[model samples]
Target: MKILVAGATGKTGIRLVKRLAAGGHTPVALVRKSSDTSSLPDQTQLRVGDLADLPAGVCDGCDVVIFAAGSGGDTGADMTDKIDRDGAMALIDQAAESGVARFVMLSSVGADDPDSKSDLAHYLQAKHDADEYLKASGLTYAIVRPVSLTDDDGTGDVILGRDVDPHAKAARGDVARVLADAVSSDDWGGKTRLMQTA
Candidate 1:
């Protein structure tokens, strides 16, 4: 399988790419011209394109599309909407049109509802909107909403369900493994799971 990863250069995304490669699947890293690709594996495939301005055929020949991109904390809310909401929706649309087999979304835990009281309300709203869009896009999809992310090594064990602890934290490597599993297996299809390290 050839999987297209939208945030392949980021912490968790990089881990996902490596996981896919080790599993004997081709991972296509979607990156902008300005992105630093030094962290990616030497033989990893690259597709130059920006989420803010996606190019045509970005999803072509891809079996699955994983949206792991984020606008980052340094940027303002506007950029969050641009990349997380609008950008993700655009990619979902393209993936659906391109006959991609599945779309696995990397969403946050609070995205089920954007709380005005939370500092991350806007960001959560963006993810909520994107998640909704993917659900309605007529594509086989998996939405993994993980709690706070950490840099710890993966334990290969996770707690997944709707009632997971809200304050729990997930290791980036574990999240990457779950996303990779979703791409290679049907067990995660049409499911929306909240994840945390067990």
Candidate 2:
């Protein structure tokens, strides 16, 4: 299967691309013109496109689309909306139109209720809107809402559910494995799970 990864240059996304390649699946990195592709594996395919303004046929010939993009903590709310919400929604629309099999989202723990008080409320709200849009888009989807992410190595063990500890942290490598598994297997279809390091 050809899996299109929207954030293929990020910490987690890069790991996912590697995992998919190891699993014998083609990993298509959806990148921008200025993205650094040096770290990607040799066999990883590239598709130049921006989530902010996706071109037609960006998702063409892909079996699965995984959205792992983010606006980062340094950016303002406007940038957050542009990437987290609008950009994700646009990709979801494109994936559906292109007949992609499933859409996997890497969301935050607070996205279920974005109105909750927090410094990241605005960002969560953006994620929440995009999540809701994916759910109602009539496409097969899987939403993995991980807790705080860390740079630690993957343990290959995780705790997943709707009621995970909010204070727990998730390793970026572990999250990447989960996302890769979601696309390579059939178990995660139509389900949303909150995950943390076990």
Candidate 3:
């Protein structure tokens, strides 16, 4: 399957690309003109475009899409709305329009219930909105929502549910592995999962 990755330069996104390729699937890295490709795998297929306005046929002929893009904490809510929410929605729309079969989202843990005590409420709200949109978009979908991300090496073991501990944390590598699986299989489709290290 041709998997189009939106956040190809991100920590998990890079890993997802590698994971997909290693699993014998073609991964298309959607990158911008100024994106840093230093960490990307060699000879990666590139689709140059911004999330704000993707080019025509950006998702054409692709089998599935994984939206792992986000605006960092340094940015404001507006950027989050654009990248996390609007940009993700754009991909969902384009994927469906272009005949893509499945859509998977790399969402946050608390998107189902944003933590009011943290500064991530807006971001989570955006994720929740996008997740809801995908659920209603009539596309085979899965929302891989992972809790606070860590730099620890993956254990490939995780707890998945909405009732998980709020403080649960997951390694980006593990999350990437799950995302790769979610894209390639439908065992967890029609479900929005919250994942964390077991």
Candidate 4:
């Protein structure tokens, strides 16, 4: 399978890239020029550009596009909107245009609950909006909403379903692996899975 790995520099993103390659799939690392690409698996192909700068046929021959890019920090909600909301939406449109068969979005767990009024509500809202867009995009898609991320090791066993469990926090590596598996899972096709620990 040809896979597009957006935000390939992030913690989970890098793991996903490596895991995808090791799984015998070709992963195209999509990253902005400013992102550090050294940590990515050497076998991964790179597409260097911002989310808004995707070229025509950028995702050509790619079976799946995994959106792992995110903007979170002291940069405020506007940046979140630009990268998380608009950027994600833009990628979805491009993937659709490129005829990519599947899209797997790495969204947050709280994204679906409209009543979620956390300090990072903007981030959640952005993911929510993106999730809806993917659902309506008329394409095969899977949205994986994982809870508070930990840098802990992956066990290769995870619970994946409709919402993140309140009592669990997920390891970043585990999430990445799950997303990769989702791309290949017939049961996960066109499904939005929320993942957390058992």
Candidate 5:
């Protein structure tokens, strides 16, 4: 399968690309011209563009799309809305336009409610709006909302669903693995799951 990974050079995104590669799938890294992609594999196919305005046919021939991009902590709220919300919606639109088979989004644990008072309320709201757009976009989709992230290696034991412990944290690798698994599997489709380490 040829999978396009938006923000494929970011922390968790890089891990997702690796996991997809390990699973015998071709992971296309969607990167910007200024992005330092040294971490990506040498043979990883590159699509040079920003999520905000991807060129036509960027997702052509791709089987799945994973949106793992985020405006970094160094950025402000506007960037969050631009990239996380608007950019994500644009990707969902492109996925539908390109006729991709599946779309998986790497959302956050608190993205279920736009009005929720999560610490990163704005970010969560943007994600919530994007997730809703995906759900109604007439495509098979999976929204994997992981809890606070950590640098620990994946344990491969995750607790998933709405009633999960909100205080838990998931390793970046673990979240990446789950997002990759969700891409090719139908079990996670049409569902929004909050995943955390058990």
Candidate 6:
């Protein structure tokens, strides 16, 4: 399988790229020019571009497109919508245009609740919008709404299902591994699965 990984420089993206390549699948590293991808495996292909500026043919011959991009820590709703919601939508458009087969999104747990009173509600709303768009796009998609991310060691075990617990959280590595599994699974096709710790 040929996979395109957006946000390839992120903590989770790096792990996803290495594992995909190690599994003998072709991995495309989609990153902004300013991001550091020096740690990515040598076999991984590099594509320098942001989701908003994804080049024509960026998704060429790709089987799966993993969306891991975001405007990190931004409180502004407009920025959240632009980079998270609109950016994800843009990638889906390009993927469809390029005939990509499946799309997987690394979203957050509370994203399904647009009216949540959390401080990050705007960010969650952006992800919610993006997830909805992907679900309605008629493309094979799996949206993984992971809980609070921790840098702690991974448990290797994850709770994978729809309707996550309100107080759930998981290690970042665990979340990424689940995402990799979701992308490679036939079972998750066209399904929105949430992830949480045991």
Estimated TM-score for each candidate? 0.98, 0.97, 0.94, 0.94, 0.96, 0.93
Q: 1-198, model 5: which lDDT tens digit per residue?
A: 999999899889888888888888999998999998899876689998887777788888899999999988777888998899999999999989999999999998878875555568888899999999999999999999998899776888888996678888999989988998898776887888999987
* Residue-level lDDT tens digits of model 3 in 62-171: 99999989888799999999999999998999999988888999998778877778678899899989999999999999889888999776899877885667687899
* Overall lDDT per candidate, in order of appearance: 0.94, 0.93, 0.87, 0.84, 0.89, 0.83
Q: After superposing candidate 3, which stretches have Cα over 4 Å from the reference?
A: 115-117
Residue 68 lDDT, candidate 6, scale 0-100:
80
lDDT of 2 by residue, 67-116 (tens): 99999889999999999999999999999999999999999998998766
Q: In what order do the candidates fall by lDDT, top score first?
A: 1, 2, 5, 3, 4, 6
Tell me the lDDT of candidate 4.
0.84
Clashing pairs in 3: none
Q: Rank candidates, TM-score, best first.
A: 1, 2, 5, 3, 4, 6
Worst 10 residues of 2 by lDDT: 180-189
| Candidate 4 TM-score versus the reference | 0.94
Clashes of each: 0, 0, 0, 1, 0, 0
Q: Which runs of model 1 end up more than 4 angstroms from their true locations? A: none
Cα misplacement distance, residue 196 of candidate 6 (Å): 1.2
Q: Give the true-structure RMSD of model 1.
A: 0.9
Candidate 1 lDDT over residue span 80-152, tens digit each: 9999999999999999989999999999999998898999999999999999999999999999999999998
Q: How close is candidate 6 to the true structure, as a TM-score?
A: 0.93
